[model samples]
Target: MKKLTKFKRIVTRIIVLTLVLSCAGGVMPSTFTPNAAELYSDKEKYISYNEETEMYEYSFYDAYVYDIDATPGQIMLDIIPSTGSNYYNYYYHKKILITWHSYNGENAAQYDYENQKLAESIQPESRINIKFAAKNKYDDLSYKDGYLGWESHKDFYVSQIISIRNSDEHIYGDINDDGIIDSFDVVTYQKYITDNLQYKLDETQFLNADIDLDTEITNEDCRQVIDFTLGSSKGFNGATNIGSIRIDNTVSQAMSLGVKNDIDFATAEIKFGVDVLKKCYDPEKNNTENILISPLSISSALAMTANGADGDTYEEMEKTLGNGLTLEQINEYMAYFISHLPDKDKEKVYLADSVWFKNDPTLKIYYEFLEKNRKFYNAEIYKSQFDETIIKDVNNWVNKNTKGKIPRLIDSFNIRSNTAMMLLNTLYFESEWQEPYIDTIDGTFTDLNGQKHLIKEMHSEEYQYFDLGNADAFKKPYLNGDYSFVGILPHEDVTFNEYVANLDGKELADGLREYADPETIRLCVMIPKFKYNYQKSLKDILTKIGMEKAFDPDNADFSNINDLSVEGALPLYIDDVLHKTKIEVTEKGTKASAATAVIMGMGAAPPEEKKTIVINLDRPFIYMIVDKNNVPLFIGAATQLSEN
Candidate 1:
């Protein structure tokens, strides 16, 4: 069994070497033929006499090629016995001679049976051919003479054409050469740096392990690998754009849930966003009012709060945010999504979460809830006195997380004495257009109330066009193509609010999935440069969306958040859900930020042939900043335009 296994290993090694050589450039054909005399009767044979050649021929055994490294320019070759005997028994009175020659037949180096291995210096881009031979000490003479001197045998040659190049030219952090920089590479690199690697890394892998290109393996390289694995904004030398390949239990669970649903989690996310939009936008009362909301922000904040709820409150929050998925599933999905989000220095989508509870001794916050949030959401937890100072701290955290887009989230009046805790989620997105609009033309935007306002419209030609039946839409990609700005202009017959009201999540999701081929269809997009800030208290909105139990102080079940066993402890209910957003759409790109605070009280398609589609947003239209997965990060409407 052992011999069979060894044979299989040798065969695998030869196949792998053949493949490597083939990939490098080419491989020389095998010219080895077994001698019949040696194979038939090799009891104590030293050499074989060839009848055709009329001379003594050397008996050769099989040789296996292990690996090749370019930096040191060495090839690992293992010569084993053909009869599966020990080396000592097979070559007892014999000495093996290995020689390497350059491509031009120039002798490079020679070795004489030193541990059956050889290492020689071969320059890069040079081809080396190796030859192996064995000579045995003569105890008897042949028919030629009675001499007892050692005689040279016929050489056994296995030629390989190796063209090695500098290792620094390969992927920087892809140490395993799996075509991705992932956690496995991080582990392998860490093992290499620590000198605990079981197998030696080749030249290419060694260079890849040096992530910073400092020519030395250090902890910093391991740190960069870890950072890249964890999805850092500052990537590991340009190699960080390969996307994350880490798959933990949370990611697995999320993926399983998505697969079970027969649709992506992004569809459910978009459904929740569209639901919020429909509830927030009042077509009759606020027809001319601009509305903006980040469903991601709202959902994240509510998800954190859901971790602290028990029964009806948890169910309502889960339904509103997760679209019928459980809290655990939602948490896993959101966690995986946020961690794997593609982020660049210039074009970034930063999402941050925090939970602050009043530091009063009477109100004891649940440790399990906070730990779950920290583990899944990476949320920052704080215990504060809930005073004017705590208000500033919360606002400061919001301001920093939003990249100053939202300077203040909560004032003194917003943080009441009944507020026991606050769960906040902030999203900051800044990205330049994939194709910047270089021209700006004076245009007029007619509001829903038929009020015309002079505006400066940014004009650009987009390729991705979407026909929403009642709405003409166009998608303009941001830099890196990880996110895009989708503009949906309702048809003249249908009002903006009417279009939004009639639009369902499935329709929008399916419509976004279908778009005309850019090569065939061209979109002439003219969008008004708009800047706006929107703030609203979502207590009534959420209640209208079937979250009434969460706001009901008497009926809300938030026992998981605080210790209700304490005497005279008022039940914690969601006092209000505050949402604030700011957006600036210019010729360069869009810079949008949003903050959602769940104030906790003692409560909680292919187009056919060259067609041009013109989508002019000369009136109220819906705009959304969506991720690569078509999940809406920020969805809003531009009903009215102003200079500010």
Candidate 2:
């Protein structure tokens, strides 16, 4: 009897030990938990290699980013991987860093967003490699374009930096990433203290030096402007002219076909610059010997780089749309659209890599869709000269794209001579806020004159909110992927302009996502749905809103262009800028469309928007178009919106 009892006790002990070793190991000792550093000691253990993008992806939260301000147009991320997302021994990847490039309104590269001149000139590097599958392979709301049957596995990441080139022989100068011209960048400026530096800056370095992002080289007067760099942040900070600008102006120009007969201008052309990029700086790298750079990449810091612009991967765009596209379609279209083109031509064309057509080969059909709906758009149809009926088809597409806001586009398109080779000029958009705002109450708010008015305000809840502590207000951004509507409400005491002027020193910060971050505010929110059309000379507004250097003709240098002769170096200029937009909402979603036509010298136009509330737009409120860096491209306040 004693021996049998002892045997039972031994069996129970064995079973307990087995349970402790299992995955759901219940109640392990506290000492077993690893410290942050200990767990991170072998960073590679946390991540896995993405066969598709050829990049090592880190699965851990807040992975290592060696320098947010690396080369001129890049941010070096020191990714140390760990088990995350799918780590039951297998690795699960999450987010990654990206770059975006800024647009050269007139000259390609000359100064920073604050209009500060670049101390030196460096050429931009080409080859923006971004993959969407890496960002949203597991999410449900991604979108794709074209006939490639929307890619199902295009997890995309952002590439948000832009780098351009310099035409002159000046050295590149930019030492810090504060976006300010400060003394810390003395070495950068010192290199260019004289134009005759022995070693000619590689095309890559010169590309990153062009801030203001115009292609002009610097002279002592512009480059060495005595006080310019005193405290300026010279690196790009990821801001472009509303990546939607080209699209906005395209439809506007076509609809308001009223020509500017009063001001006789010599040239009006907008160039497409996908392949025309040069290397951006990696301040953190600072390897003058073999300066490493990736050009045509989205600018991680340049204020002019847009999310939709180059630099970022089409994969990222697809991932944002959630589930409309597939990976094969995206790859096929990218291969086909960019199939045969010169470096210059490639630099001038860009397409949504993720969006695939039903019949992959008939891409021009998009233009035809617009052409058929011309009257509503009031746009002209430009016929294509490429495939058999590209001209007529493109014209119809212009109309369809605009959804009646623009009419008569592509009226004189030549697929080969006009549409195919020309810079794109058209736009189409339709999106509603995920969380709609309805004006259910008449709330009192103050305007500029210290006058209080009983205004009907729109109210709703958002996935996130940004605290405008500087403006004494709260900002709620409603996003439908790329298309979005942001409504800001200032504290009743402050005026719109007063709020804006004070915002100069403050950072323009916003954080929106499915999950809240530390900086996010979980506030009960209210948003007003107010629609108003704004008309301004695109060029004039660019200058008024802080990007003054680009319009400086003599200081502009854009010789990287194949057509633009480099007799020595050529000064640059912008000929025309146009914009048009429309917004509508219904039970389904918001339908917003816009176009921007920027004619660089005498080039082509490119075109590429949200939704509603129950509130009437009667009282005044502030509105602005700003870059990611907080540089306001355009700012205004609407006093009233006639319901008529």
Whole-model Cα lDDT per candidate? 0.66, 0.30
- Best model number under lDDT: 1
Q: 1-644, model 1: which lDDT tens digit per residue?
A: 99996776566445434433442443322322233243345322434444542333333322112223322233333222222211112222222223333111322332222212333443222222222232322223211111122433532322222222222146667787545665456556555655656666654467567654334677777666665555453555431111212112222211222222224567877888888888888876856668899988998898888898877777778877777677888887777766766577558888888787777777877667777787778787777777777766777677777765676677788888788888889998998787765436677988888888988788788878888889988889998888899999988899776788898887888888878888888779888887778888988988988888888877888888787766656678888889999887866678899999999777330007888788889888888999878878999978888543
The runs of at least 3 residues in candidate 1 whose Cα sits more than 4 Å from the true structure, single-residue gaps closed, are 1-263, 603-609
Q: Once superposed on the true structure, which residue ranges of model 2 sit more than 4 Å away at CA?
A: 1-398, 408-427, 435-457, 472-485, 504-506, 510-522, 543-556, 562-572, 585-589, 602-619, 623-637, 642-644
Overall local distance difference test of candidate 1: 0.66
lDDT of 2 by residue, 63-100 (tens): 22222224444333322221221111102222233323
- Winning model by TM-score: 1
